[model samples]
Target: MAKNLDVIEQTTNELTLAERQQKKPKRKKKKLKAVWMYTLLSIFLVVSIFPFYWMFIGATNDSSKMFTNPPTLLPGDQFMTNLTNLNESIGIFRVLFNSLFVSGLYVVIALAVCASAAYVLAKYNFKGKKFIFTAFLLSMMIPYQATLIPLFQMMSDFNLLNTYFAVIAPQLCFPFAIFLLRQNFLAFPTELMESARLDGASETRIFISIVIPSMRPALAAASIFLFMTQWNNFMWPLVVLNTNDMYTFPVALSSLMGLSYIDYGQVMMGVTLATVPIIAFFLTLQKQFISGMLGSALK
Candidate 1:
């Protein structure tokens, strides 16, 4: 019996060694694949970040450094100087204020309007419901340029041209926002609304208290889009905003461009400043925005 056990143990050890030898090449292949994947991702990361790095470098350097043969890759000491020049060129503070105020207000108002419209469209059963939603989607297909002239004319007739209202009001009923939020709203449990109704809760109360709290992700996502659209809007504001004091970031930054002698430093500085709020806003709501987008997609 002892001799038999010894033979069995020797056979088991032999089989284990053979198995390890067989897996060795597979393990090496996996490691090589992982290395290549990480290398490619690193290269992509650098490529994606290079433009933003260049923007910063340009912001901190003189205008001439931007066009130098070697091209400056390092940040210089001219950030403050460029910032000062940008302020003088475009009234940076007023531009920042206008952008922040208009974008913020537009996000708030547009969110309320869109969320309500989405909620009704998603949960209610009524005549023309499908037709209305289809119309909204079709409206998105219309060229935005086509509406610009009509919108400008209406604003002009109403004495709203050159006002923040002109900028904020026209796109308040954003179709994409409505569609995104409606998809999310559709995923919400109707049973919960019914339960609230049974408890004598009003529609507005249910929306404000229960529904809104649960829809934070969707709201955050929609708010980001709304804020970005208003913040980066250029053509409409340029058409309407007659005064420099009323110009948003895009319009303000465009003011730095000259036909023959553009100050790259100040332009880069303004662009950098213009990008900051979007970054900050997105970062603030990133988790919610991601979840909302995923939720909408799943729905």
Candidate 2:
């Protein structure tokens, strides 16, 4: 009688377990989707980073070694020669300074202008507000090339050609920067600004203390974009800067390949060096840049 009662209890337990399993469906969809997502991301990561590795290897190897069949995958002893050639080809310090100074200044000024304008457009009610923001969006729609000639002529008229002012000025009023920052500013709590104002905080103080601190991500994202644009800017600088000393890094590097029989190793070294600043800037701000990117759309 005891054994039969024990068997009956075990049978009931088995049935209950089977019923529970039936109630909850298997969750394969999420797991499979995750697998596919990870695979795609890994592939993208490898593809994006592989070129930098290849470039670094090329930077180390000589032209002959880099050009070999089953191209060189390892570092070589020719890096010093490549560096010497690169420095000789383009006075490294001059171009580096031009790029760094112009790009850095452009980013700083653009952030201020864009953030201020965005704040006004987003938070304040005024006449022609819609029109102004519409114009900003419209500017982005227009191809930059269409306005280049007129802008170049204007800069020439202003006697800003071959000057850092030319490179830095035109880009300070960046349409995209304005648009991006405005989106972030839209999400700022109006109450906070109003409360600050009630406390006798001036507009500048309110903005500096309240608005800027809250929108770090947007500012970081804008700074990265502005820096990248100004740093890689080639055509305008080409038109403006006549002297080799005045040329930015990209312009100076391109001049190397314009010569017959390109010493690819030297070119790679210059490319590697030119890429360092951008990488550093991105890495430093990548967290904010990524987080802030969604502020406009999400809000």
Top-scoring candidate (TM-score):
1
Model 2's lDDT to the true fold? 0.89
Residues 42-129 of candidate 2: C-alpha lDDT, one tens digit per residue: 9999999999998999899998887788878999999899998899999888889989998898889988998899889999999999
Candidate 1 Cα outliers beyond 4 Å, as residue runs: 1-20, 293-299
How much is the lDDT of residue 37 in candidate 1?
Answer: 99
The TM-score of predicted model 2 comes to 0.85
> What TM-score does structure 1 among the candidates reach?
0.91
- Model 1 scores what on Cα lDDT? 0.94
